[model samples]
Target: MADGTRIVDLEAVPEDGSYRLTAEDPFGNETELILVRCDGEPGVRAWSNTCPHESQSLDVGDGAAIRDGAIVCPRHGSHFDACSGECDDGPAAGTTLPGVDLAVADGAVHLADDRYAFLHEGGIDDDEPGSTSHLSL
Candidate 1:
């Protein structure tokens, strides 16, 4: 679980809610993120704590709470829509959170290999042999 490998813990996550996780990137960069369960279903949303506007962690204060189906950032009072990671308020309006591609299977969270590339807005070559992106832990 510490090596960016796919590890799922379904039982540890509750349905119809959100959970915060501290993870590391493949380069060992620690990131605080949130996972939300919108509605009674098992859908999950993953986004980094770093706000796109100022690169500040959005997990601070009461900003992590779910409001109108989005996660609010405590620092500058920005609201990140969970489903789309778009900002709904403050100076960063129309911006988006760094989205982390994740899925739920067998009752655990699984980080997608290509998610980081999307978050970074980088392109992947077709000749690549393996996934170019990975979570550190």
Candidate 2:
């Protein structure tokens, strides 16, 4: 993860829709992030593709449906708010999905590729369960 590299093209992602991309943080932890355009909105929202309940990648295809402005995980029927990442149902209900810090700048989506840079700098190990690590977006 460098300082000025673009993560994903915002134009490539459909407006009022969702897309998935795989990224590797500085520590080599690979994570899938889902970028979604909230209904009738211009900016994009992002969340970890991994479901907290079973650590399975949420279905990002047709299985990922938008209902009431939330992205629904098809595997366990969990609905997450596209803007806030709040789980609305299923086993992980009330649990919030991890947010991928990103922003639109210079007409492109800029994501902090090194999600665990802070943790590593703070002497934290990224491989440990429940470790404070960052997600690549």
Instruction: Highest lDDT: give the candidate number.
Output: 2
Which TM-score value belongs to model 2? 0.69
* Candidate 1 global lDDT: 0.58
- TM-score of each prediction: 0.63, 0.69
Stretches of candidate 1 above 4 Å error?
1-17, 39-42, 61-63, 114-137
Q: Mind giving the per-residue lDDT tens digits that candidate 2 earns over 1-137?
A: 32444656677565545666655677677566667776433377767777777776663332246677787766788888888888868887988889877767766766654472222111122344323355556
Query: Which structure among the candidates has the greatest TM-score?
Result: 2
Clashing pairs in 1: 9-108, 10-107, 25-136
How many clashes show up in model 2? 1
- Note the Cα lDDT for every prediction shown: 0.58, 0.62
Deviation (Å) of 68 in candidate 2: 2.3
Name the lDDT value of residue 111 in candidate 2.
66
| Model 2, position 99: C-alpha lDDT score | 86
| CA RMSD of each candidate after superposition | 10.5, 9.4
